[model samples]
Target: MHPSQSQSCTAFDGHRLIASGPLREVAAATKQAIDAGAKGPVLVFDDQTSLPVEIDFRGGVDDVLSRLGLASAAADAAPRGPGRPRLGVVAREVTLLPRHWEWLAAQAGGASATLRRLVEDARRGEQDRALRAGEALDRFMQAMAGDLPHYE
Candidate 1:
């Protein structure tokens, strides 16, 4: 059986009992604080209890503010301007088997130039497909308009 089931407890929100057990147990300690009406979403674990005791802070506004410090300080600390772009840049070492290397080399025209060419080809293909789709839609719309009755 769960230890919480053996104790009487209630949640701060009054929705349900958070937990129950020896005061030393963290879950029990948390439940006790909630039952006692501590506000907030956090339960701080304390060392005093034999089992970890969680102290529920009914919404630790002061703690939150203290932790947050000055917002302007954070903003000042932030690295300004656009950071380095990671895309299209090789960041790590990759190992390839001879067969795999050969395959890539075959596609890439010898391994080194493969990725660049593939990316360029993909971009061109995408642009071409988009242009074709737009033209087809335009023609379809024109045909549909011809079939519709025009108001005099």
Candidate 2:
């Protein structure tokens, strides 16, 4: 999936946070730092997922931005397929038990709509999201800060 302007990222020089903002901005900052011969082991990460971001910074800043923009362009240029392209609905297989299928069939909307509603309802709780973010952050910390004193 292509990231939007709201998709923020952070760049770190070892354990220190050097840049934090939109992907393009952070990438520019990172490229500049690396070009200026900053210390080794600089990395970038997605703030939402707490996952390391892999960016190819081989070219100039404009080229870097162009590469990042291409993803957005490609996603937007994708040919519309079946199943409500305007609504951004993608069709994927769902293997359910016969009873579950029967229940979905009995719902007011079709199986897809009903399943979407059920999933939305289930995801309505902030607790689930908070827990997931915490877990992701924990994983990132364990990978990046495990060697630090009393990281736990």
Candidate 3:
């Protein structure tokens, strides 16, 4: 399935949340709201990043899905070509110093694998920090809640 098809989305009719679910369902609901003459400007948001999503809401639901690459039926019927999309690996240029390149080349899995490992390590470190911060917040909330009457 296309990435967009799997991604969760939310639609807002102004400040009100009109729909939230798979992109296709959200788009359908957004279309319905628009067709019913929504009071405010309708906006769709990508749930992952909490970012506004731009979707062409032209024509019917099927057309909208096709335009947004959210039509699972069509995607399933299509033939896939070779490349990294299946592996979820996107290739992009990375500029590094000569010494950095030499060090990466000397690693057990070569440059790509070493870079990926380093990135994963960094991400893990960030996650650890976030976990600790969340734990602290939870403790603080528990302490504060304890002060209230009938606290559990």
Candidate 4:
């Protein structure tokens, strides 16, 4: 979901609502959840708290509930662990050539490790872009300070 549309709801154990706010606001809430021994998934919403956009825990519901000292009585309980990062609703599977697969295999020690590295690399690149953008904005503001005509 778009960052602008992202919201989050934080609950402790299972039923206690700690906070509900925008995704950006969840950073502080996440720390609070950790502090409060909340080991379950942190549910994210799109625009409404009643409907979840994403769930992040990475340890599975059983593990999360165990850590939080809660029980899942519902047989069809939502799996708590971090859900797979969805690209979008219309995801298309790409068939890699054998050589391409071989190359990726060679780079990845294993499939899991390779996937992890790819994700980390992508995340880092995004962070670097943001940093550079911020720097550029700072430089632009500094350069415009004395050059721009000001009234009032």
Candidate 5:
């Protein structure tokens, strides 16, 4: 996983949020703070997915990620030339009704190009999706941490 894809990790001190950023920095800082005798059970959460992620606070950031087989940061972003596929493109079959196919074919760029543009438009909605995911996570956290002193 790319470091950016890991999204943000938030470290909490007891019920209070202490640090928020990439997993590496958040983990290292949390470890340092804990080592300095901060009260912990420091919960680290993936901000985007709202899922819990573990960190070996005992190890350095690079050591941890390398051991886990995740890239530490954006490793490469080679530009795609004309007629070249972008990274992670997957070819799959789609079955549409005849009329649907006709509509797609009628599009200025035809089916494949129209589909690609549609996918790109959906990709642009990622931020809105993230916000919704965050909201869902907030509701979850509220329920999970409700009894704690600083739940919100």
Candidate 6:
């Protein structure tokens, strides 16, 4: 799935991971944890994007489920066609030294294909990068986010 289209979230109770899956599942799990009086705070983050997801389980399971269902149904209502969306590739000036351009020109598939390959390889390694970033964000929250109002 495209990163932008993903709704998968991971719920963390303090340093330990509680649940990782769809929004509804994570929210339910988080609710249970909160109701059971879990330690510290429960935070849910987008699995792929690493963005925070705020879930209000104060209204109980039905309210949370209804919200999740509405969100999914709204997304499903969007107009979509079979096959992947068009890859919006655009040309831009890339300034490179003479030898760099020469090497790219000498490659089997030329500069564009080489650039694409390089990007795909970097993207493939994003899971590790994202994990590091997520950890860093948690640390940041521990140090800096405490003073913020309504932190939990």
- CA lDDT, every prediction? 0.42, 0.77, 0.73, 0.49, 0.70, 0.70
lDDT digits (tens) for residues 42-72 of candidate 3 = 8676655555678877887778877887663
- Kindly list the per-residue Cα lDDT of model 2 for residues 84-124, writing each as its tens digit: 65656567746568999999899898798998898888878
Clashing pairs in model 5?
none
| Candidate 5 lDDT over residue span 1-152, tens digit each | 23444477788877767789866567666767777777866777777666667666656655665654555544434545544245443456475789999999999989999999999999999989979997868854874587788655
**How many clashing residue pairs are found in candidate 5?**
0
Maximum-lDDT candidate: 2
What is the C-alpha local distance difference test score of candidate 1? 0.42
Q: Report the Cα lDDT for candidate 5.
A: 0.70
Task: Report the C-alpha lDDT of model 6 over 7-108, residue by residue, as the tens digit.
Answer: 887888876788988776677778778788889567777765566776667677667666555343333455565444365433464667899999999888
* TM-score on alpha carbons, each prediction: 0.27, 0.61, 0.50, 0.31, 0.53, 0.45
Model 3 CA deviation exceeding 4 Å by range: 1-3, 72-152
For model 2, give the RMSD to the true fold.
Answer: 7.4
Show the lowest summed lDDT stretch of 10 residues, model 3.
137-146
Q: Write the per-residue lDDT of candidate 4 for residues 75-124, one digit (tens) a residue.
A: 33455434334633233444567987787778838656887788899988
What are the runs in model 4 whose C-alpha is more than 4 Å off? 1-92, 142-144, 149-152
Least accurate 10 contiguous residues by lDDT in model 2: 70-79
TM-score of 1: 0.27
- By TM-score, how accurate is candidate 4? 0.31
Positional deviation of 64 in candidate 6, in angstroms? 1.3
Give per-residue CA lDDT, model 1, range 1-152, as digits (tens): 11231232222233233444332233434444555765554322221221222233344433322332322222334443443345433435456678888788778366767867767889889887777767655543443343456811
Q: Candidate 2: where are CA atoms >4 Å away?
A: 1-5, 70-123
TM-score: the better of candidates 1 and 6: 6
Best by TM-score: 2
What is the TM-score ranking, best to worst? 2, 5, 3, 6, 4, 1
